[model samples]
Target: MGAAESTGTEREPLLGPSQAEATVQPVTNSGRVYGRRWLVLTLFSMLAFLQGMVWNTWGPIQNSAKQAFGFSSTDIAILVIWGPVGFIPWLLFMWLMDKKGLRASLLLTVFFMVLGSALRSVPLTNLQLRRWLIHGGQLLNGLAGPTLMSAGPLLSTTWFAPDQRATATAVASLVGYLGAACSFLIGPLAVPAPNDTQIVNSNIHWDTEQIRNRIQFVLYAELGMIAVLFAVVLLYFPSRPPVPPSVAAASQRLSYRSSICRLLSNMRFLMIALAYSVPTGVLAGWSGVLDMILTPVRVSQVDAGWIGFWSIVGGCVFGVAMARFADYIRGMLKLIAVLMLAGASLAATWFTLTCLTRLTHLPSTKATLYTSCILLGIFINSSIPIFFELFIETVYPVPEGITCGVVTFLSNLFTGLLLFFLTFYITAKDRDGKKQDNAALTRGLAKQM
Candidate 1:
């Protein structure tokens, strides 16, 4: 279908006189009432939580997977690529969602998630087969990624008034972080304890196999729950709200391309996207290697799990708070750009400090590391809500499903591809350096002996 034709549908009323009046309603002594919209927001948040949970499940267990599969950092990097690889197909899905409807798109997302999760959970006899299946599952997961990403912002735009849009979007963004937090906090419990002989120095222990099984089980359970949510969504998610006859025709004739172009062409959008790109890449890469990063710092696997958890916590807190503030000020785009810049700065600082501390072998910097982590979480994640809010406010009265899909598709696609190349280069350099260092050390020791 043509873009314009695809976007054309029975239009819902953008705003009634009463609703329009309420848009500028003064804060009474009782304060603003967010009644049913809260319910809609809550559901969208749950969707975010589920998406985050699924995506993050791999990070805390990366070390365990490496040991179990005899995989190098490069191999693990490939695994990381699998997650965002799904972003490529998301554009088509977005188009389809726009052409079809929200319910159709949501159903498709659930299907992909279910299929991917089920595939990932299946045991394979050979290592190659397992890798193939896992990566395939990741691709399927990516298919659903855009749907969930779009759904939250779309819901926010449709259900919320202008003043509430930022806060609603922010709360939606927080849900995913909350999901990530839950995964990290629960990962340790899911894995079985190592045998006594496996313990090193009475503190360190590793159980690679058990961790994999635990992860598989979690994915299976998540898939089941997602299937349930799909049913609920199919039944309950509205296509459009009731509209007055006079304005309905105008709303129905709105063009998806016009809305998308408006958002994509905005200078503010580009700035926010660029500013967020680096930090998003860093976070994505860091999460994939989180276990390895924490190992040398005396953080055990169990303790390291808390890193993702706390990062999510920080993200959730900041996402909600900043979103609400932005809503109040109608500064969603500005807030997003500021948050992205702040996140990038914090990440760079943390990276520098981490390198220095490691090279100098300075006194344990646990507190410093922890502080950096919290800041990283808050700053890095705050952009999500802000971006969502900006998208909704800027693309007013447009078919939300299509607009959301396009924005998410572009953002994820760019960010994902950028990280893929960055990951390859960084891992390759680190590997070469390690190999050279080992060889030099060996030669020096032999000469001394």
Candidate 2:
């Protein structure tokens, strides 16, 4: 969270480089394997996906949600903000995942997710109560966000071979992005934009009653999926493998205090954390407000949602391919990360130009916009596995759970803080600006009379 402040001399005893290896138990590669590792990966990925889906329920359906719950742009932003708000208590979750191991954290994750999803599905008629329940549900769901994402590396370490670790992490970690992608499609398709011209008010397009009914339908359907996953986790999920899968998996890790001390002192980890967190944070934050950002460019909700869907879907496909590449080539994590960063920067620049073209005579086509989204998504998102691997390798013998959790927790915190202001500066301010423009026009007409 801060620049490296401790000197090497001061850091050495607090589980620095010299002492860090001492914490790890001697490890051996074993021939024994479990047939159930794949199932465990599937469950981890699925829970993460569901958590991501819950986080994004509003972004793709902002208009309908506003109508259904009497929400302002600010209110919608708050719900998205909660996606990262779950990280404020990052240490607690990290300790649970790291010290308590996978099953304890997973148990808590299911509990929070069930309560969160179920709260939203309640058929409450009171608008205020409905809003409260949704927000509360988001908060509880948010609490699970850190564990959902960070568990991938831990799960892989516990259940996968040395050769398969990075790939396993990639498959589990990136599936959450897939969950986000699915939500972009599901939210809009399930709660389709009304074709009717009927207006509920100055801003709302669909009837609140109709929108509410559809929203409940979506919530109930998603809740059914949640119930299924909850049952799966409760019935048979394991804390970890009975035997270590690889040498790295068997290492003892430093205590949290020592790990934090070493991490804060290590300049390389600091750089990696920054490189890993900031861009991803911005990407996640923007997804929540994409509808509002695209409105001025004449993009519809369905189009925006699909763009989001492709962005994430393309990224996941590209990520899986690149993870295999990284695994095959070895030691190219830094190169891969840098190249993707450069490409992503260019794609983002082009994407920004396409969006701004709406203000110019040469407005870009939808094809240009969609292409930019795909390119940006693939370039920026494809490197996630590399970064996760880099983080793990950079700080070996440090527990993978906390290592991933710390970086991801920082990313989520950055996102929540970013969206909080984005709501004020972009979404809410834009709405106020429109009202002011309308008032100014009305006054000018009155003066003319």
Candidate 3:
């Protein structure tokens, strides 16, 4: 499928593939596309899936994680926020990819992926110790975030032809999202939310024998899967295809610094980046804390899990279809992007209104809540591939890895800030409530006097 040529109106100077590539035994320099590229894509997509699964392990199971580990909402937010924090060294990893190639960068990914799960799977009775170990594991996993999140365009460009790049990128990118979707179900099913919280040091800490055991089981399961993936990738995956798939696949790229400068200066690309980041970031942040947000509305953790799972799954279904549509008619990129963004905006507003617990006049039904969430997922998640393809088209001759990397970075940054701000707001609300309680008690004492 990738061997077919892309039909479009474009002009370009053809400079062939790079010179400094690993030319292994039993391979030729012919630029013919190969079927094995799909296999490579499948493997890379698995990495995407597992890494994303690891990242979201704590979010959807908010009550479960809290009940099992005695975690605060702030703690939960901090755990889920690690992915963005991991991107601090993203440029260093990008440098590794550019110099050491895709294979080395992916190795770093699998290493962190498995290692993080391993740490989380450790059995420890002391709550502080167990929580710290889990934090360590999450931090290690965070180190893998940039590659797992940003490498979609790079992987697709490396293996697939031009005509299939958009769809390929969509699959590679959204598969991680699918893993995230599955996480919503897996946590809820594996570990049922317990009815009681264990009190420790005069504070309410959610923990029970059953809940803790189930949480450990979930961690162990993830570790086992990641270990298998690591072994498979190490044994078989290659850095690049034996032959280039297309002109873009084979073509040399601009320097990393030069590409960043060009992207930074380009107004069109910046607008696209901004458009892509906001809703995407908010939805992601919102989803990560879905249980927390919906708790005030009386939604159970299990129900929130289902909502996240189906919403993302539905979005992925719509996203893949839209990606194919994007491929079929490249000219309609702008219109399609506009329509999806508009739909996403309305869906987000609708979901917000439906979730408002304090608004006495708003219609806050579970039915409307679910519908709005699903619609948000479809419209927001579907735009990812479109934006990726658009970025590459807008900044031709720049490497796909760099462009998508920066794009993903912006989205993660927005997500991180939103998570932090929301957490802070919640914490401050608790403090204010405590202060008012103390003031009321003081007034009662004065009246007795």
Q: Write the per-residue lDDT of candidate 3 for residues 1-449, one digit (tens) a residue.
A: 22234433112313334553333222223234557778788988988888878888888777877767889888888888887788888888877877788888998889988888888888988889989989989889988888877888888888765666778889999998898889898988887775531122335333477777888888888899889989988898888875655566766789989988999999999999999988787777778888788777777777888888888888888888998877767577778889999998898788777766478468788788889888989998998888888888888778878888888888988989999899899889879988999999999999999
Better of 2 and 3 by TM-score: 3
Quote each prediction's TM-score. 0.78, 0.88, 0.89
- Candidate 1 vs 3: which has more TM-score: 3
What TM-score, to 2 decimals, does candidate 3 have?
Answer: 0.89
Runs in model 3 lying further than 4 Å from the true structure: 1-31, 196-207, 357-360, 437-449
Put down candidate 2 lDDT per residue, 160-218, tens digits, no spaces: 76556778888988988888888889988878565432233536455668878888898
Question: Each candidate's lDDT (Cα)?
Answer: 0.62, 0.80, 0.80
Q: Please, what are the lDDT tens digits per residue for candidate 1 over residues 141-214?
A: 76667767766665554555445555666676567668867877776567543443234667655577665677
**Candidate 1 off by > 4 Å:** 1-40, 192-200, 203-209, 243-254, 296-298, 331-340, 358-364, 393-407, 422-449
Model 2: pairs clashing at backbone N, Cα or C within 3 Å: none
Q: Which ten residues in a row have the lowest lDDT in candidate 2?
A: 1-10
| Candidate No. with top TM-score | 3
| Order of candidate numbers by TM-score, starting with the best | 3, 2, 1
